[model samples]
Target: MAQVHLLANRKGGVGKSLISLNMGAVCADTAGARPDGRPSVAVASADPQGTSLWRAARLADQPFDVLDISGDVANVALLKSLPYDHIWVDTPGWAEITPEEYAAGKDPLGDEKYGTLLSALLDQADDVVVPILTEPDSFEPTWQTIEWVLKPRNVPFVVVINNWPPAEGIAYVEGTRAFCEGHGWPVARTVIRRYRVHTNATKVVTQYHNNRVELQAREDFFRFALEHGMRTAAAKEVVS
Candidate 1:
């Protein structure tokens, strides 16, 4: 059975899609093939925007299969039947559904019109990756998602500080790390710095293995993966 990993955060602009695409590609590249010789990794896009799907389409040859499991609760069930070792889900940024909206019969999954689809996806996820920026506004939603959703479900998760500023932002990063640690949340030791390469990565088919300009970003991701136990499956073979 495939382990489903969700890249989720209620706040936008936190590098969720970027992390999802790269992590999914890396998982596909590193995963051992199935007994039938088929690749053992795939990605599912639950985001209504379809950004990950668009990027996958742009690639001449994708590292792994990409499924646009958007809009319907049935799609989430469909993903469970796929034969893959690892399935990464790229979820939308809006995760919080206000009581007023719920009472008004408005869905939090947005205009996609899929009621409770996000909840269904979360139910299927084995693990969740939360990308957070080191700012007050971003931190608020990230914390809420963790406290209200993940914690309640007893799901394992790691908070990754993405697009961190360089030297000048060191203090802010430290503060954020301390805050998470104090709250008993698992925060990745690896911090991804702001880089031009990451910003422009969506324009082309790129992964950590093929990226040249921002090698550190790739390194950071690798470290994060290692910390999260994702490297234990085939780390040596993947690195070699």
Candidate 2:
């Protein structure tokens, strides 16, 4: 079965794009890096900004290819026809959008365009991964999304806390933990602490905040992949 991972969040500035491309790069590396005969791994970018495409271009030397999911009538049809080992979906930030505006822009569902993309993704996916920010305002929207995705959809998903600041006081992290635990959210054991490296790193380049390469950040992501059982050590070959 194909592994469809959605790098989604209802709110923007939550690092959805960063996680999506990183996950796609990792998955592509895991699948042996080549596009042909190799396991297919593509990023179905639904954002107008084309952040994923830019990132993919930056890493064009890598084995895999990044396909743009242009806002065409055939977009969904094309996605449905793809045969890949994993499809990493970079969804739009829609919590700030009005309901009507979002619905008009989506597929059949009364959601964002990414919602239509999500519908197609869920059809082919066995798992979905959501990135949630630790801020309180963002937390409510994240949960709202969880409720929506869970309704009548049996696809399994896990939530990762992004942009986590260590000096934000213990109450913040504890609050997030308690909220996830109380609401049955599958929070990952390793929290991605807010590092300058993470903030400074671009899509293709490996620069970090402290003027160093953040290999540890990549390792943390590898661990996430392992815990989720999405990929194993074999996938690491694509990175080199």
Best by TM-score: 1
TM-score of 2: 0.76
TM-score per candidate: 0.82, 0.76
Off by over 4 Å in 2: 34-39, 60-63, 70-81, 95-115, 169-171, 201-213, 230-240
What tens-digit string does per-residue lDDT give for candidate 1 at 80-198? 66899888888877656776875696644565443366688888887899898888788878887787668878777889988887866589899889888988998888887877766
Superposition TM-score, candidate 1 onto the true structure: 0.82
Model 1 residue 161 CA deviation (Å) reads 0.7
Model 2 has an lDDT value of: 0.64
Clashes of each: 0, 6
